[model samples]
Target: MPFSSSSSSSSSSSSPDSKYNLTSAIRAQTQFLTHAYTSHNLVIASYMKNMDNQPPRHEGSTFGHRVIHCDREEADRRLWNDYFSEYPKYSEAMFRRRFRMSRNLFIRIANVVKGHDNYFVQRNDRIGRLGLSTLQKVTAAFRVLAYGIPADEYIQIGESTTIESLKRFCRAIVDVFGERYLRAPDANDVARLLQIGEKRGFLGMLGSLDCMHWTWKNCPTAWAGQYAGRSREPTIILEVVADYDFWIWHAHFGMPGSNTGINVLEGSYLFSNLANGIAPPCHYVIQGQQYHTGYYLADGIYPKWSTLVQTIHEPRGPKKKLFAMMQEACRKDVERAFGVLQSRFAIVKGPTRFWDKCVLHDMMSSCIIMHTMIIEDERDEQADIQGWKEAPTPEVDIARDENIIFQEFLARHRQIKDKEAHYALCNALIEHLWE
Candidate 1:
């Protein structure tokens, strides 16, 4: 009774019975329950928080967990500027003069490549990034032709473009510019080249021909057969014939070195049956075999053919001096052409550093074609020079002199015994006689 009496008095002091009925009392009780539950949850959360604050107990410590803090945007901008400043510049006029082509020519060519609708579909979209003008693109090509630098380096120096963009630009230029510039010599062009050679005292010389080995890097294992014999390095052998003016008359490139020189020569349309129509008359006998006419000039490496003139290795007394002089003079054209080509394109002065042979080949071929175009354009610009006007007569006289020697040799050989008999006599004379 005492406990009941205390409870009734506590309930009356709290609030009126109507003011707090079963529904209201139940709600008040629920509020207290939610608060108690929340407090209990807070205590559990505090316990877990304390556990998490302790160091992880594992096999090893996380000593190398680094937090990178750098200004990424600023670093990227700096790299872009650094790449942009690598190229050298010349006055627009100087560029035009050196290339010997009008600015319009390059612009027209660039527009054609840039406007190619199909190029837009590429995934990486390199063509869109080439910000260079037409003139700049042409100049970049010149850098490749003249400097022989890797296309990436050329583009960097020639245009304010990225290496990747330059690669695309170079490929596009080669496609468009090569078609526009690197034309095969026609009959008329061959005749003109011969005329220029004659003017330069190369008698009966259709073109000043030479062979060079362009060193390659990281050649495929399958291409071991094509490496240069002496160097034991991968290379692409190129045979080119240029005029006295250094305008390329014929180009035979892309043949593997594993192929014989004779085979390569034969495969070249420049040396094949097509040449017979364009080659000039010869004044020298080859292998002691006399032919009616036609000849090419070759170095000691080539096999003697009636269609080729080679300097005699051994001649008696005074004739030796003359032959040496003639050989020296004839070989100079090729040397000069190579020298000029290398001087302008510094990249090809030695072995390429690229790891792919195909890329290297394309780079080299494009440079060569571009160089020829430059020479052709330069020659056209200087067509009226007095040096060329007075050049052919002296060359014709030398041809006559060579013809006289040929006629004399023919007459003497005819006077000897039968052809087989004469051949045996000559072999016997050389076989036993040792210096």
Candidate 2:
């Protein structure tokens, strides 16, 4: 345990003790290296696993989250479904069937109008930089008829179309439909309708006619006197006539009330025909005056003319009661036509807010034309006129059968009866006319 320095030195130099210290130092260095190596390997393995699990970064997904860009095809399909659903009665296929028109038809018609040489020449300019497809224009025009949306909304729906294009499309459709459908009755057509009415027991009646008023939003300050009425608003007047079949024969619009009814009537070609002795022959004596016989059913607001049948008043007595009833019945055709028109094209249901009188006139005329077309399209004549000509009995069941059919017609059009006023007026008019 206690040795001399020399002996300790000699033993340290040659004995295993010397080697033990050297081996220990070597082992310490090796152990440290092994621990560092194992730790580094573990760290590298963990980093590699994380890198394997991580997703590749995308620009859209990295910051704002993944965005779904809908394909144009899908967008169009959805929009079409939405548009189709708005009219439950018409499926996409049914609409195609009933209209008997295609995208190509719309395009062709649009091309005729849009590429019109006359229009370009008149404008003295080339086509506008922005243009809609013929199909788009037709669709826009029909959208106005079908939905009556505002111009701005229509433009938005039409995507790239401008308000001017929408207006032009409307005008084009009107012009086309007017030429094809709103044509004035030829002598033959007039004669045919008259004969049909006569066969239905409506004697001497050319047509049932009436007038309606639409309020105007922007009355010209200088022309207020000509346009303003007791309603304290400026308004435009529209006179429309329908035959017994509820087919519109004529429409006269844009007359100011400052013009008397007689004046307005005189301005129409319809009235000109009567003045020129072109009316049919069927004579009825009125107040001791015998006139060439043709009758027009009108409202109480109209003056009694030899040619115009008015509801009987109280002074006309018992015979007048029958006349009033007949007059009311005939005049009902015009009212029913108006109701159907207003119901189908809701744009005319309320006061028109158009700022321009000319535009208003076109809008009203277009509405009338469109209304007539729809009536022609939708009416079931066989059902409407069935058994209307049976002779009236003392105890005629006016409230049964045909009368029920008439009521159903009104109901189908979502019309309500003005029961109290209508019956009273009927009784009074009948009493007067019969007397």
Candidate 3:
């Protein structure tokens, strides 16, 4: 019993010694780990401190530094007072040639924009220096439209600022005049157009329909396939309907150049109203037969719609030849309008530089609105100068019965896709033109 007790006492005393050795070893390992981490952190901090003391190897070139202008203040004064006030540096003719509008029109547009947005207002720069005046900003936008020149050349404004001004100007023009200029024909407009058509020997013609392509120089590489077509270049299509006086009545833009005019026509709003049964009622008599739908003179590419008249393909007979000649000549109205638009706004003449399609659309829309506005203004002035007066009463050939008109409209609607009606109308036109 005494030997067993002595052995137990010796083992219990050795257990404490083993536990103390194990705890001491663990404490030493933990201290070593902490010291190693601290050393690594110190090395990283020292390297960063050394880098902070080193000189920069390359410096970026700063732009928008003040350039010396000897007469900037005088030029500003002249633009603000002389040109804007009663006394001006340029004549009215010069103003029109330079900006494509009269001085009065320019001022009016400027004032309208300045009132709409603060961006058009002249404010102090961050350094408390005066920024560009409204005249300078709007003129910058006009110059871009007029010459298609880079914004940096003609004005002291930065390129970015000039671009913003142009975008804003176009947006403003559209906002202010879009409702009047870009509207669908009302009842009165339809009546006037019909009367004009009758005077031109086309009893029910509305206008000419055509398509134009505006080259896109900055199309994204990813979208190149969609926009680049048989033209071997990127382009955006503009489908237009223009009347005799070069007023653009409809503009459908942003179609990829890969598509044809026929494709554009298929998707256009030209037929939307007709399809929805909301088109303006057009009634006219040709060869004693009445047509309820007005027609547009299109090229060969357009479909055989009842409301479209295309030139005879390679006409052999004298009647067909005459019809072809008249149809083609009339179809040139839309082309002429496109040419005039490009000439007026050189931004449209050259390749478009913007990346966004919406910007290009707004730019085109604004140009067309301005073109129509100018046309109306000049037309009124010419009418006044020539002592032209409005007719007191318009002659109606035959008063159509309401029931008959409704039946005729239904018949026309049924023939929207009828190729036979198209050929019949063409034959009737040829006979009428020949007679």
Candidate 4:
């Protein structure tokens, strides 16, 4: 019992030492952890300092952007010295061929467009650098439409700028010239057309009707089935009625259907005013039967409607042969117009690169309007068109009750859709052409 007591006393005395040893070890570990944590913090601070030492970058964009110095003012100077100066480097014919318009006409168009849209006017960048001049912008847009090339082909003008310019230019042309140039045939116009038709052997023939197709390269995949016909190529159709002078009086575009003038004609506005009884007076006698409405000479694809006159398919007699020859010869007016239109604005001739249908519509409308303007300007140089221009516009009567007007409109609509009138007109035309 005394030995046990002595051992317990010894253990009790050594316990304090063992506890001190353990506490020292824990303190050492905590010190080491603190040092390691300080080192980690220092490393993180150094990494962040390195990050801050790098060059600042633009927000939402990466560093190392490229900049090409373009002396656009010099480009404008060169353009003026080459084309607009008193003694220019290019000839008038060269100017007309390259620009697809006269210098005066280009100037007039530029001035008008600049006035209509502020985008055409020259402006400064945020850095106070002068941007492209009016001449440069218009040239880019016009050349793109005239050549069907990429907009970046212009000297120093970027593709984005040129594209924007082309968009605005097309819109301005539509707003400025669409009303005056792209119009239905009025009384004077109908009279002049009838006079030309009389000389060509048809009495009430207004113009030739046809349709053309434009390949849509960027058509949406969802619409491939609807727009793609037998060719399996997505295309948009344009239906037009043009005269011998390349004047397109009626145009219905953007329908995806057969280019044979039948499907497109179903929804066309060619005879809207006529069927509504508000059309210009067109009274002409064919074989002792007077036709109060004019007709368009279409190919065999169109329906037998009084407003549209088609040629005989298999003519077994001499009269039909003569009529077919004359009709076919005259019906080429619209085709020739299509050829010239394609030749002028090669954009429509080539595959369309735009995806938006509304943009395509604007582009087409602008092209057609510009085409009609060119025709009028060119025809104005002739003495005969001047006489037609001098003809007085016919007066329209504004007096009519609503019921009577509606009745007349229905009557005209029925007359336009009359198959008997179509047959009678065809027979009379055959006899007239034979005579």
Candidate 5:
């Protein structure tokens, strides 16, 4: 009975209702297979395709560059006559004022930069017309840096050429002069600085440490809040250690403006050497107690770290007040360095126009390098700089060999962070400065 009744049951199961459900499922599967991508996925695929199809900016922009054939040869002749000639229109004094360096220094820099990059060499463009002369290019770059002017100040140089020249100049300066100028204090330097600090009543002080903010006018919208400081302006922070002279011994740039001195210090490796026992020996006697690390005079915002000396707040007595006065005065060395740097190179003084933080970093580094170069070149003229520049540099190193003592390193690190030492040093300084 079951076998004979199966035909009717089977036929009923295959009726139109069942047939319709099967057909519906098939149609949904077909639609999904045909159009699997959602709008968001489609948008992403199209963007990737576009990016793949387009040439890069640096290469693509040159495809139809409008070559401006200015009187570059005449410009070169005039530049040589005014500066490099035996007899010239501008005197050596004017050269220093305008170039922000001596004539000989500028020539040496130009020659070195030309060797590194042939773009500085006088050459003909595609059509065989003489392009911007080396002097023209260098001068244009200097003018922009010194004055913070738009790139098109010179009729001979187009805006693009001027901008390119300036960028190349910054890169070359950083590459060529960075090592000599941007170096941390070596052993000889440490010794000299220690002696100078002793003379100034700072005993073991390396220099003054401080932070400066450079406004970022073209900060990305997403980063505006992160880069804005107390002034509510988008900016970047620079942490520098500067000596009594405007020589910046150490620099760390590109911190978001919202950061304080502590944040920048965390981001920098300034204390890594001290932590590892590779820092230059900064031995000094304070109240007959021997200390191992040099200290920087920092502001009150910084933490009470042993290596940072902050002025006493609300000093009640003549001794405390005088100590505070002296501490604050010495701490202004970094601030004064910042002022002199900005005064010399107006580009960093004004709001930054470049969007790339790396470019800004390079620009800042190069400016500091050139500033030091100028300082060294004219050290003879700087009355107070005579002693430190002449300090004998013996080849002394903290890490005598590669084998390190982990225990001693840890002990040194602990000493660096010891708040008790910080207080003790402050008291010793108060007494020392009083006498």
Candidate 6:
């Protein structure tokens, strides 16, 4: 530690003490800086390596990452108790109100779509998350359709998942029941419809044809100009044909709201099959004149096509007034169907929240299909309640009426668009009602 005077005197070649000490100090500082720099680089390299090996910032948060695995047998048992049991958690009325289908029908639907809707096993190690039960998924879809609620709030399902469930549900219903419920009339159907029409005093009425407008809540602003009608609000028209039992037989949708009932009728396929000679044989007699074409009771806005029977705007006498009254009353079949459809599924009653036109179309189609299904189901129950029986045949051969003759079904169907037939039929109908 002492100044080494002897050593400095012996080392003359080392140069002056001041310069030598300064040079030594600079070398020490340089070594220290180099060591510090190396340590800093090593730390930074370790951090970069760790970052490279790390997962993405959004990992484990997305749907693909968050796996929901379910035990199939267990889930089935739970759903069976909760929904399908003889003594289920909810009553039949409650089930009907919530899902808009009877418990049995709901179970049938679930069975049909089970394979398509089942979630895959997600975790091999342990149960990662329980995939939503079939009941949960169905109830979620129903809530969206019936209450217009954000299904995300219920069952903690994501909005996207809820939307997917709804899409699948509608698609499945259409696939499973569309043919049976939403079908053209067959021979039996024609017979029943004609029988009902004759009883209602409309000799050849097929059904009522009308148009309903569903407000588009989420309609895009760009299309507002085209969709907005006289109501000055965005709407989509549904051209529907409904019978006496509120069973909708035909539905043509997706027309913009700027059109009238006449516009829809002109473009509709109401008489397409008749025009092509493929319509079912319709036979009826009014005022001793036989006709081969059936007609639909429509409002005054409809065209004077023979298939369309519009009531007179201004009736002159008691007979015309009675005819008008009956026509208007019968025409409300479609209006009632629309009302029941909206009342059953509030999704159609309220403005639709979906933006896609196709989704809206599918939604309406599904609702109509379901409506017909419910009507058919109720009709069976009504038949049971009424204890309807086939009338006993009476003994024939006592009286042979000269006016009785066997008539054959016409091979060539009449064109339903003849205006002359329309007037003739109207006059006959008026005379019949007058007598």
**What is model 1's C-alpha RMSD?**
18.0
Model 6: lDDT to the true structure = 0.77
Q: Estimate candidate 3's alpha-carbon lDDT, on a 0 to 1 scale.
A: 0.82
Model 5: residues with Cα > 4 Å off, grouped in runs: 1-69, 151-155, 381-408
What are the clashing pairs of model 6? Answer: none
CA RMSD, predictions in order = 18.0, 23.5, 5.9, 6.7, 9.4, 13.1
- Give the best candidate by TM-score: 4
Across residues 194-271, which tens digit of lDDT does each residue of candidate 2 receive?
556555445446688787767766677887788876677777777888876667777888887566556666666655
120-157: candidate 6 lDDT, tens digit per residue: 11223345644666766776776787777855543555
| lDDT score for candidate 2 against the true structure | 0.57
lDDT of 1 by residue, 1-435 (tens): 999999999988877666669779889999999999999999999999998999755432355544333342343344334332344254447646554444445445456656652331222225444333333344455445554543333233322233333455557656766765555554444445545544544434565567777776666777766575557777777787765666665667777666656766766776443232223333322345443333355676665554444565766665444654565576667768878777666666776666665566566666666577666555655563334322222122333476775775565334321345433323322322221
Model 5 pairs in collision: none
* CA lDDT, candidate 6, residue 96: 82
**Per-prediction count of colliding residue pairs?**
11, 16, 0, 0, 0, 0
User: On a 0 to 100 scale, what is the lDDT of residue 364 in model 2?
Assistant: 69
Q: Give stretches of model 3 more than 4 Å off.
A: 1-74, 80-82, 151-154, 381-414
Q: In candidate 4, list every pair of residues with a backbone clash.
A: none
Q: Candidate 4: list runs displaced more than 4 Å.
A: 1-64, 151-154, 258-260, 380-404
Question: lDDT: which is higher, 2 or 3?
Answer: 3
Q: Clashing pairs in model 3?
A: none
- In candidate 4 the C-alpha lDDT for residue 413 amounts to 81
The number of residue pairs in model 2 that clash at the backbone is: 16
Model 5 lDDT per residue over 56-154, tens place: 644334776555446766767877887889998999999998889999999899898889889999887787887777778888888888889854534
- Please estimate how well model 4 matches the true structure, expressed as its whole-model Cα lDDT: 0.85
lDDT of 4 by residue, 76-128 (tens): 88889878888999988988988888888999999999999999888998889
